[model samples]
Target: MKIKSYLLIILIVISAVGLSVCSYIYTPAKYQEYSVGVDKEPVMAPMLKGASAGVFPWSPVEKQEDPQSLAKKDKVAETKPEAKIEVVEPKSFTKVDDSYFDDAVFIGDSRMVGLSQYCPEIDSRATFFAKKSLTIYNLQKDAWIDVENGPKETIFDALSKISFSKVYIMVGINEIGRGTNEGYRDAYADVIKRILEIQPDALIFINSTMHVTKEKSDGDELYNNGNINVRNAALFDLIDNQHIFYLNVNDMLDDGEGNLDESLSGDGVHLKGSCYEPWHQYLLFNGVVD
Candidate 1:
C-alpha cells in the first residue's frame, strides 16, 4: 500500500510539471517575462484569427487601401471648371458718299497723280500731295510736291500747313523690288508715324497695292501680282481699325484670278484715265464716319 501511494504522488507531480511547460510555450512573447512579484502590469494579447492568428499576435494590423478607390479619390480632387476668355471683333467698313472725302487728302505715287488729274469730282473736293515717283522711303526726305504759289516741299511739310480729317496712302508699287517685305513695312510704318505727328486728328487709310494685269504679271518676275499680295499682307498687319484702316481697292480692280482687270489698266500698273472712276467710287463706298 505504501509503494502504491508513492507511485500516485510521483504521477501527480509529473502531470503538474507538463502543464507548467505547456503554459510557458503558449504564452505571447510580450508576456513571457510576467512574474507574480513584478510591479509592471501585464499587457493583454491582441485578438487575432484566420491567417494572422499565430504571427505577430501583439502588433496592430494595418488596413490596406484598394488601388481603384485611391485612383477615384485622386480623379475627384483634380476635377474643376474651365475658365472662359473674351474675344473682341474687328470694326467693319461702311459706305459713304463723294462728299465724305471733302475733308480728306490723298498721298501716293503716279497713280495718285492720275487720280488728281482725271477724277474731276475727287479733284474738286480732296487735296492731293502726290508725285510721279513718290515712295514711302523718300516721302519725308524728297521735296516732291510743288505747292501752288508755294515752293516744292516734302509731303509732311505740306501736310503740316494744312488741316485734313483723313489721309489716304497708296505708294508701294514703286517700292516692290527695292527691299524685303519687313523693311518695306517698317518704312511704311515710319511714314504713318510722321503723318500722325503732322495731322494728329486725321484718320489714315492704307490702300492695298493694286494687282498688275495678267500680261504684266506673267512677263515680270519681281513685279507680279504674287509679289504685290505679299507686300499688301505686310501692310495689313499695321491696321488698328480704330485710327488706321486698310482699304483693299483690289476688291474692285482685280480680275477673277487675282490680276488687274485687263479693261481697267493700260500699262498693267496704272489705270486708264476713265478707270479712275471705279477707284474713286471705291473710296466713296468704303469711308468710316467715326
Candidate 2:
C-alpha cells in the first residue's frame, strides 16, 4: 500500500509539469502577434506549421484590373461626337446696259478733276461740264443750285447754259463738316430737286465722296475724312428713284488705308492716270463707258 501511494504521487507531478509547458507554447498571448483568436483556427503555411507561427496574419488574394478593358474605356471617351456647322453665301447685284447718255454734266469738288481727265472715250457718248471746288447746294444763300461756283451765283444763273442726258454728282464731304446729318440730307435733296427741274429726263449718277486720310493740319482737321463717311451714309438713305443711281466709285480707287496713294492721285484727294485706268474699266464693265 505504501509503494502504490508513492508511485501515484510521482505520476500526478509529471502530468502537471507537462500541462504547464503545453499552455506556454499554445496560449492566446503566444499567437497574439498573428491575431489568431482563441476560438478561431490559425492559418499556418504548410512549411511554417512545423516551425513557430510567424508574426503576420494571412493576407487575402489580390485582384488585378484588365488592361484591355481600361484601354477600351479610354477609347470610348476619345471618340466623342462633334457638332455640325452650316455655311451661307451672299447675293450679287444685277447687271445693266449703260449706252443711253449723250451730253453729261459732272459736278463736285476737286474729285471731279479726275473725272474730267479720264479719256474722251468715257464720255464720248456724251458731252461733259465738270466743275471743281463746288458743293451740292450753294453754301452761301442756303439755296438749291444747278451750279455752285462760289456763293455769288443764283441757281438759275448756273443752269442757263446746259442741257444734259446724264448728270453725275459727287458732293457732301464739305457739308458734313459744317452741317448736321438732317441738314446735309435736306440740302442735297434741294439740289437734286433743282437739277431735275432743269433736266427732268436725264439719268442721275450720285457718286460717293472719295475717302481721304485723317488730316493733321488746321485746314483739314475740322473737315476730317470721317465727316465724309457720315455724309456717305446720309446720301445712301435718300436714294429713291431707279433713274437716280448710287455709284461707290471709291471701291475702284481706295488702297484700304484712308489716304489715296500717289499712283491713285498726286494730291491724295484726286484720282491719277493709273487710278483712272481701273475706273475706266469699271465704267466700261458697268456700261457707264461710251
Candidate 3:
C-alpha cells in the first residue's frame, strides 16, 4: 500500500510538470509582446482554443502599414496645381485703301481746309472739321469750325455731338508760334484725350506738319524746320505704334531735304491743287488697317 501511494504521488507531479511546459510554450503574453514591438494600427486577434480551456486569453494586435503606401499619400498631400494666365495681341497694318476713310473724320487748321478745297473729290469720302489757322487754344472758341449760313458752334461742342471710326488730326502750325515744344505737346495731348473720350474706337492718324519751302524756312526762324520738327517729335511720342499712327504725308510732298517742294506750292505754305493728288495717293497706300 505505501509503494502504491508513492507511485501515484510521482505520477501526479510528472503530469503537473508536462502541463506547465505546454502552457509556457503557447502563452498569450508572447503574442502580445510581438504585436506591441511592431509599428502599425491596432486590431483584435482571432479567438484561440486555449482561451476556452482557460490556459490563456487572446486580445488586440497592432498591424504594420506598408511604407510605400504611406510615402505615396504624403507626396500627394504636398503637391499643388498651377495657375493659368491670359495673353492679349495688338493690331497692326502695312497698307490699306481710300474706302478705309469712308467713316473717317479730319480735324485741323488751314492745311486741312486746303485739303477740302484742292481735292474736293477725295475729301468727299470723309467729313472735314477744319478752319483757317486753327489752333488748340482757339478750337473751343465760338465759330471756329462753322457751316454755310448756319449758327456757328465751338469745335468741342460740334465734336461732342458726332462720332467717327477713324479720326485724322493735323493742327500745330499755328500753335508752334506761341508755346514751347513741351507746352505744345501738353495742349495737343489734352485735345487727344478729349477726342478719345468722345470717339473711343476711332483709329487716329496724326499727320506730320508739312515742311515749308526751303526759301520760306530760311526767311523765318519760328516758321522753320527747327520748330516744325520739334512739334512733330511731340506728336510722334503720342503714338503707341499700335493704336495711334504718325503719318508723314511730307514724304510725298517734301523735297527730300526736309523742305516742301517749291513747285508744289504757290505761297511756299499751301500745296497747289495739282500736288494734292500725290498726297492723296500716299494716304491710300499707308493708311492703317487690322
Candidate 4:
C-alpha cells in the first residue's frame, strides 16, 4: 500500500513539470505582444556622442547642435548700437559798416541841411554842401556851405577845393515841380558831370528823392507820389551801377503806403535829424567798402 501511494505522487509531480515547459513553448503570437503598460519607454539606439554625420547638400552645417539648442528655443535678440548725426552751419557774406563812408560828402537841399543839423554821425565824418532851397539848377552857382574857418564857397567851388573819395548827391525835390522831366534830367546830369570833372576818382552816389508825408502828397497835386515816382524813375538814367549808384532814401522814410512816415518829418519834406538814424544805418549797411 505504501509503495503504490509513493508511485502516484511521483507521476503527478512529473506531469506538472512537463505541462509548465509545453505552455511556455506553444503560446500563440497573438498572445505574445510587447507589454506597453509594463515597459513605458521605447526601444533606444546606441548613443553617438560628439560624432558627426556628413552634411546634406541642403544643410548649413554637418555636426548636430546640442539637444537643448535644438529644442523650441528662447531667442536672445542682438542689440545694435545707435548712429549719431552731426549738424553743420551754412556760410554767408561779411557785412561792411562805419569805416566805409568815413570820407563821404553829402550834397542836397533842405534834406541835407536836416542831416547836417541833426545827425552827429554825418557831421563828425562828412562835409555837406547844402542850403534850405538848394536846387540842381542853382547848386553849382548859388549854393554855399559854411566850412571850417574858411569862406563859404559855391557847391562846384567846394568840390574843386577838396578831392573826396565819395560824392553823395540827393536833388530833385525842389526841381520836381519846376520843369519837365527831360529838363530836370539834363540839369542833374550836368551836376553829376561837373562833380566828376572836379573829382574824377569820386564814387558818385545819386540818392533818390524821399517821399513826402501822406498829408502833403494827398493834398498837394504838385508834391504828389505820381510826380515823385516819375522823378525817381528818371534818376536811374544817371546810374551805371558802377561808381554811380541809385540809393532810394524814400524806402527808409516811407509809411509803406508810398508816403513818408509822419513821425519822421517835422515838415512834410525834411526828416528830423534824430529820426534819420535809420537812413545812416541803411547807408552803413548798403554802401561800398574800400
Candidate 5:
C-alpha cells in the first residue's frame, strides 16, 4: 500500500511538469510573435498600456505616432530659415567750389538771367539758357533763348546741342498765376525728365523760387511768398537727394518772417544787383561734389 501511494505522487508531479512545458512551448500567436530567440534566453514581450506588469518586466513599449503627425514634425524640422531684407537711405549733399560750375548750365526765368549777368564769377564759368519772361510751361515748346551769334532756339534744342556736368533750374515764379499747382508741378516734372534724358550724367539742382518782399506779398495775392512756397513744396518732392537736389536760396535772402528782405531788392520782385553776390556765394557753398 505504501509503494502504490509513492507511485501516485510521482505520477502527479510528472504530469504537472509536462503540462507547464507544453503551455510555454505552444504560446498564443500574439505572444509567439514577440518570442523570437527564446531558446537562448527569455525574450521580453512588448509592454502595452493596461497590460499586466507581471507579463513583461524588461522595458516599456514605445508609443506609436500617427503617420501624418510624424510627417508634419519632419517637415517642420527640415524647413529653411527666412532670408533677411536690406534697407537703403537717401544720399546727403556736400560743399563744392567754383570749378564745380565750370561745366555747369543754368536754366530758368528772369531771376536766372539776373544770376547769369550779376554773378560775374558764375557767369564766366557756367552756361545760361535764361530770359526775362521764360516759363517752364513753354520752355520745351517755344524758342525762348537767343543763341549767341545764332537765331533764337528752344531750351530743349540748346540743351540737346551741349554737354554739361551740372544743371541748375529755378522757374516757378512765372508759372504761379497761369495754371493749377498740379499742372505747374507736372510741367516742371516733365521738363526735369526731359533734361535727364538729354543729360543723364548731370547732377540736377532744383533751386527754390525766391520769396517776394513783405510789401509785394501784402499787395499782390497771386505773386506772394505763400504761393511761391506752395510751388516750392511741389518742386521739393521731385528731389531724390542723390542725382537730384533742392536748394532753397531763401534761407540766406529771407527776412525772419519768410519774405525777401526789403533791403535786398530794388523792385519788390527782383533782387538788387549787389544781392546777387550773396546768391552766388549760397550756390558755391551748397554745391554737391558728385
Candidate 6:
C-alpha cells in the first residue's frame, strides 16, 4: 500500500510539470506589437561620467594625460573664444510697449506665407502677407523706372501700412536665381534701407535664404551653387546695425547633405507647414523672436 501511494505521488508531480510546460508553449504573446508608452517615464541613455564627444571629428587621440597636460588643456579652454551666437532677447521688441505696434508685420514672397501658416501663434501678434512670386517691380510696373518686379516686394509696402514694432523679411531666392550676385546684393540692400527709413525704430529680422535640391536649382541658368554663396555673403555684409538682426535659420533646415530636404518643401521652393515648426524653434533659439 505504501509503495502504491509513492507511485501515485510521483505521477502527480510529473503531470503538474508537464502541464506547466504545455501552458507556457501554447499561450499567446502578452504583447504582440511593439509600442512606446507615453505614460511611462522616458529612459535616458546612460552617459559616461567624465568624458564627452569631442568637437573635432577626426582629431588624433592622445595616448596618456599627465597633471601638467591636463592643466594646459584647462588653460587652453579658458582662453578659447566663446561661440558667437546671435541671440536677441524678446525684450528688445517688447521694450517700447507702443499701442501702435501691438501688431507685427511679415512681408515677402511665397516663402513668407508658408512661414506664416507654420507659425499661426505668431499671426496673433501680427498680420502676414505673402503674395506668390510678387516683387516690388510688379507693384510699380507702370512706373517710369521700368523695374520688372523681382522675387519679393519692397520693404516700404510693409512699413507704410502700420507703425510696426517688428518686421521679418525672407526673400531673394527667386530673384537671386535670375540676377548676378552684385545685382541681388544691391537690390536686397535697397529693400533693407527702405524699411529702416520708413520706421526708424522698428526691429528688422532678416531670415537666411533656404537651400534647395540641386535638381530644382538646376532649372535656372543664372542660378547655381555659387548663387547661395554670393547671396549669403551679401546678406552678412550689411549687418552693421544692432536693430537689424540676421538669423540663419537655414542651418537647421538643411538635411546635412548641403541640400534642402524634399519633405520640407512642396515645390522645392515653398516650405510645407510641417517644416515651419523646427524653423520657428530655430528662430526662438537664435533670439530672432522675443
Predictions in order: lDDT:
0.81, 0.59, 0.74, 0.71, 0.80, 0.60
Give the TM-score of each candidate: 0.68, 0.53, 0.67, 0.63, 0.71, 0.55
**Evaluation by TM-score, superior candidate among 1 and 5:** 5
Ranking by lDDT: 1, 5, 3, 4, 6, 2
TM-score of 1: 0.68
Which has the better TM-score: candidate 4, or candidate 6?
A: 4
Evaluated at residue 181, the lDDT of candidate 2 is: 81
Q: What value of lDDT does candidate 6 attain over all alpha carbons?
A: 0.60
lDDT of 3 at 149: 86
Pick by TM-score: which candidate is best?
5
For residues 1-290, what per-residue lDDT tens digits would candidate 4 score against the true structure? Answer: 99999999999878755543332332222112322321442221001110123222233433446677755343422334456787543222135566655778998888878777877866778887777778888874564667788887678888887779888887778887798888888888888888888888888888888888999988998988779999889877787765677777777779979898999888887787679897877676666544
lDDT string for model 1 (115-134, tens) is: 89999898899998888878
Clashing pairs in 3: none
Model 2 ranges with Cα > 4 A deviation: 1-101, 123-125, 139-162, 213-220, 257-262, 287-290
Candidate 4: segments with Cα more than 4 A from true spot: 1-95, 143-152
- Badly placed stretches (over 4 Å) of model 3 are 1-90, 140-143, 147-150
lDDT per residue for candidate 6 within 1-290, as digits (tens), equals 99999999999988766644443332222110121332431211111111143312233434566799999999999999999999764343222322322456776677777776667656556667566675533322312111256443333553575687777777767666565667666666776677778888877778777777666667755554457656777778777546787777778877666667777877776677777877766655554343
As a TM-score, model 2 comes out at 0.53
Where model 5 places Cα greater than 4 Å from the true spot, the runs are: 1-86, 148-151
lDDT of 2 at 290: 23
Candidate 5 matches the true fold with a TM-score of 0.71
Show pairs that collide, candidate 2.
Answer: 102-126, 103-127
Instruction: Provide the lowest-lDDT 10-residue window in model 4.
Output: 42-51
